[model samples]
Target: MNFYKNNEMVPMTRRYPDLKDKVKKRDNKISIQLIRAWDVERDAEKVLKIFLQNIDKLSSYRYWELLRSVWIICGTVENAQFFSSLMKSNKPNRHYFSTPEEHEFLRSLPDQMDVYRACNSPQDGGISWTLDYDYACKYAKDFQKNMVLNNKINKSEVFAYINRNNESEILIL
Candidate 1:
């Protein structure tokens, strides 16, 4: 698993010094347990791997959580790239969203609309964005970032609409 440091991808152990030995020894199960204690820093790539490797072994809720965490914890561009690859062989299950409200929010979007994203700098190839401009601005404020990018896109380009906390986050291909 990798973590971003100064905008560069680095080994997860580098971000979590305690996991260094466990990761080096390939003790992922134990490492995972320890990592979870850190909460949001929860070894996301490893969780995704576990979900893919043991899909049938996990409970439906666990499956849903793991699937969602890819975008939640991983870099937005990385999450987009990963899902883009998956779309060739499989589409994300609607169950991965896990709430009728989330489905309803997606259904409510217009066919063509504006999307916004906040970042320290403008970037290309990002898929994760918000339908709410204020939501994007809030994210920018949280990080003290300056840029807010806006674009008009068709719903046909969207891979998913994730509105878990009313953030109106959308993923596009």
Candidate 2:
């Protein structure tokens, strides 16, 4: 029987002697074995950098899949922003972002839709929406501006709270 590690085929007896019995019992259709965790403390930033570096080499589906995984694993605002940027770049054909579940996810992200253009105007020209050009332009621009402003306000509030906490700590000391 043949065994594989990291997608490379290897001799079963030489590579994984312990799995020989299991492999035989499974009738050669055995797939996926759990290996020891090598990088239990893997850095999220390093992983994101590596993924972005190789983003262009991946297919659209693969890219979205990896991005979703990164977002889930890292669960950081920066990762969310990266995903929004990727979505904006592919705005004209953002079918993945248009699905009901994905649309809800996008809506949940703060300031993500701010950078997205979903209208047909000279300034926001790409794909045409079903609404009138003037209405669409106004709606898109107003929505984006409000979202950005809200994001900035929320960030300032967080910073102010942190600063206040630090000031109180210094006073206690």
Candidate 3:
């Protein structure tokens, strides 16, 4: 029994070793261009175009980063609508927008402005699994309040969290 249990745990642990640690470290870094686009231009279309062009190249984690960046710039309501329309037009495979959690977060935002504020705030808790609606809303509100009191957005630290390793470099193209 001990041998079987140990073996079972090994594969699970090996599958994603130090993933959480990597994410925690990466969260603080943002690309200067990304910050400039959001802060200076504030052009949702330009940002969305970059995201759309490079959508296929993104890893799941990068996808969330793009979404969060969009939320930060466009805010929850507009970004949600933009994504909904994009999804309708593109019809990409399952890998692109795989999670129902993402869809729910977008669709339900109009009624949850406070949660949107929390989710977008740079100082708030970074993206986590929001599988449950009520929990997500409550968590976002708490995160927003905490961020409001303790932290402020820092633009220079922000790095574009996209995967440039892939052939499709959106900004370049």
Candidate 4:
């Protein structure tokens, strides 16, 4: 589900302003897959860099799906073993955050939303929110000042959002 599909389209005069302001409808359920963009030739850091560089290709619905999945994965009361399992590598041949660079990348995933944007401004701008990661940008401006994260607020007015965490948040993703 791409975000631009259902988004209110501008007139032919506008020529589609920016990809970030567009959004499509969301489904009750979402599917997510964790991708490790690395192989033996490329270390985890290199993989992560490429992955981050490609963040702007995702759509708004895909972004929502990704964030919701990240919320489910990171924001929970699961036990230590569960957390440990989370730490465990999803791969049989590689390690989770095996390299120091990989560890830093994972640690900074949430805050690096800006960096991701700066790194990948081309190839469209949807990927920033689509790929699975932390630090969601519910709004296009959350990376900047005037951030608005709660997409489902106030009859589509997102000044205030009721996030999946059930917490009332302000205008920042």
The TM-score values for the models, in the order shown, are 0.61, 0.31, 0.30, 0.20
Largest lDDT belongs to which candidate?
A: 1
Off by over 4 Å in 1: 1-41, 55-65, 91-95
Better of 1 and 2 by TM-score: 1
Best TM-score among the predictions, by candidate number: 1
Per-model tally of clashing residue pairs: 0, 0, 6, 9
Q: For model 2, give the RMSD to the true fold.
A: 20.2
| Model 2 lDDT-worst window of ten | 164-173
Q: RMSD for all candidates, in order, please.
A: 11.0, 20.2, 16.7, 19.8
What is each predicted model's overall lDDT from 0 to 1?
Answer: 0.59, 0.32, 0.38, 0.29
- Give the per-residue lDDT of model 2 (tens digit) for 95-173: 3322334344334444312222223333322221211233334545654523211111221111001011111100000
- Least accurate stretch of 10 residues (summed lDDT) in model 4? 24-33
Write the residue-wise lDDT of candidate 4 on 1-173 in tens digits.
23223223322221121333333221211221123322234243443344334334444334333432333334222332332342332332122112233233334444323222212234322212222213334324343423322222222221112222322222222
The local distance difference test score of model 2 is 0.32
**How well does candidate 2 score on lDDT at residue 60?**
51
